[model samples]
Target chain A: MNSLFFYISEAVIGMKRSIVMMLISVITITISLFIFGVFLLISLNLNNIANSINSNLEIKVFLKETVTKTERSKFKQAILKLDHVKKVNYTSKNIAWKKFVKEYPHLNLDNLFENSPLPNSFTIGLDNNQYILNVVSNLKTFKSWVEKVSYGGIIAERMQKFSYYIKILGLILVIILTIATLFIVVNTIRLTIINRQNEINIMQLVGATNNFIKGPFIIEGILIGILGSLGAVIFLKIAYTFLIIKCNKILPYIPIVQNKLEINIILVSVILLGIILGILGALLSLSKALKRYSFNKVK
Target chain B: MIKLKNISKYYQSNSLILNNINLTINKGEFVYLVGPSGAGKSTILNLLLKIEEPTSGELFIDGVSLLRLKDSKIPYLRRNIGVIFQDFKLLPKRTVFENIAFALRFYNYSRSRIRRQVYQVLDLVGLTTKLDCYPTELSGGEQQRICIARAIVNNPQILLADEPTGSLDPETSWEIMTLLSKINMRDTTVIVATHNRGIVDDIRKRVISINKGAIARDEEQGSYNS
Candidate 1:
């Protein structure tokens, strides 16, 4: 307990001694972590939007009016059994006509077609867009019952592919940004260690153990990391709130993850990430310093 | 309490700094390592501290062979030995008391214990009133005194002073030597390396004179010359 107090006091004194350099280090860490947090937030919202769109996609299978009722029921059962198929809703010709007319107010069914020309159809909702082609091919195989099988094939496929690419790009970007942040933080701590070279030498010469000398430095690094992370998290929360409000006003159709609980989770994660980065940076620099200016090497 | 057997140190393959040296100093002995510059006085002290490993030799402090000791055990060995340098290597930013306390803190002594020990050392070095003064704020002699206080604060069995008064006047040199003698009287083995002929002649303690890298003379109640 006494040693713990000494280590903490030493770390505090060290921080005070190099206040300007430490401030620079903390600010650099804050900026780096904040930028990384922004990237994470963008990627998360993009994934959420893509998921919503995929869930809303549906395939329409038109049936021949001459098909028997038993065959129509079998077709519905087959679709429901297929992989990725979520649910199937059957619509009779008369209901389809009513829905069509409701969708297009100017259209008069009696004028457009002599007698309800709309055919019975099955609206197929799927769990995923990955099996869209397979489901379409399977529906087309039932030639006797299926008159036409149609889905937004080109658009849905493009959207799915785009979402996949976005995820990959987001991962790559986060990795690069994290590495860059680590580099900056490590260098900053290195400079702090170099500034305390003399003090370190004195401590070593006076019979201070390696752990005794390194404990305060590690604490200093952690403290700087926590301070930097706190600043970044606070700034990110405010910036994210502002961005969400602006985006809501400008593009309401864009589905964003706006749950208060989720936002809090992200903030907490950012703080944790900031701390981890700080510790990693400090460890890297301290090990380097130890290698270069070991206690035994002091003249 | 300190023993060296056939100690040899060489930076280059061909040139030796300390070659085939052997020496010993028992407990409570005050010995002066008298030599000219470059005669390997500092090298011998460095060897004892294990700062620079000897090319060949065995060093034993209280029967523990330093050469065979693990790297992790070096700090523990150093705790039993106190070293004072020619430049008075005190932390410039720390007060005199902190400088003394710095050594004790490394050993994880309680705060009260450290404070008590630091005060005791401060009083021993006759700087009890200068506890709060920084090294930069103190005179040359006073700074050396703080260095002494820091060195002996741990109550090390062996105190090695390498040119402790190399930068002080004759009177200050005598004062530092007197403090060292007082420490030696308390059964601490004190080894001072110096060419300060005045103090060497005045104190007339045991002297080991070195010329080149070998011992030229070893005498009891020895003076500056002969």
Candidate 2:
């Protein structure tokens, strides 16, 4: 439509008029988003580390000494068929005694053990950490043959709680920053409105609709928001790359978020959040500016 | 036709802008609203534009009551009535062509159509050569011409100019007045609010003089102070 192009061009011109204010808005948004992105990355890698460790914490199902070969084999098959069960390895009493002796080389257990008293055990690996508690509870149901089920109690829950807290704290801080950024954007738009008062008055006199007059301003906010998001993307990429490299060097064995695709996705979300913030700021300031514009100038 | 029946406006309880005023101007009639500063001449123009509603009164144009019109219809109502101001309110950064074409943005006119209309209005105001000049680049008279061109670009049935020649020299004032009169000849009702005694006397038209918030005189072939 004819009006769409006009709105875009006018928005561009308006920004050109108040370029400094626009830059300030962009910088403020970028800083806010960058800090927000840092928290997101931290939470993401924390989850990554927890996942690596949980996969290794397999459930050790110790079997009763009186269980027969057929029953033991059937129990192992049932565990393998469980929804979250990935793999199950059977260790006989002889193998368990040998592994225990190897782990504790200094102890003189030859006389105390008598005839290899260690029970046969089934080591069960699961597909995901979320299934650990449920699988442990399910293993306990085979009470006739199963003596005990242990999957490093309380550690998985503690890791989950810690990550959840980090995410919540990050969300709170980002919200505060977003609010502050919104105020800055509102202030910048106020200056733009004042700068373009003459044009607005002219538009009003020409019988232009309020939407037509306000279109450029809304577009200005969106543009500033988009620009700010791009700035954040660049800053996040550089800062994350540097931090990731340093983390790898300092804690090489620790798992973290190093994949390119995941980083890209987070950046995309930040961009979307920036645009939403921009629109909100624009709408907020516009209502205030327009409600009083004609009243003060045209009255 | 425009009609105001007992129109009154009050900014504050103690300060009444337009006191129980009544007037009528028919279609295609050229009229001058002559008054001293703060005599409520501008207020009358503002009321006609519905920029400010009357505190207590009725305004009718073409037999429709403006007070009864919804807020959403105000823009469409304004489309038929063009207004120019004393300060030649042209966008300073925009070229003369853009300044005139700006008014046509409300409608869905094509680019070429808008260009044609802008050129036509510029020619009508005898400033076709200054199409690309910015407002600052033009003289006082030329700037006012751009303002007029923008006002009439939409082919509005009524044009209200508040002190259109307030900042011009005597010759330039005559030039602007002549253009307005020429546009009036085309059957567009013209209402100019001014206190220029020279132009009012020289150009014979309906003049309405206001003292305070009430009409002091309304006469055909009226002068500045008669």
lDDT per residue for candidate 2 within A42-126, as digits (tens), equals 8898787777666578899999988999999999999988889999999998989988887555464655776788789999988
Which parts of model 1 have CA positions greater than 4 angstroms off?
A55-57, A60-122, A125-131, A134-164, A260-262, A295-299
Clashing pairs in 1: none
The local distance difference test score of each candidate is 0.82, 0.87
Q: List the residue pairs that clash in candidate 2.
A: none
Tens-digit lDDT track of model 2 for B1-226: 9999999888866687889898999999999999889999998888777778889999998888989987667788889988888888888878999899888988889899999999999989989999888999999999998989988999999999999988899999999999999999999999999989999999999999988899999999998987
Fnat of every candidate, listed in order: 0.57, 0.63
Error of 2 at A248 (Å): 4.2
* TM-score of every candidate's chain A: 0.66, 0.69
Give the per-residue Cα lDDT of candidate 2 at B81: 89
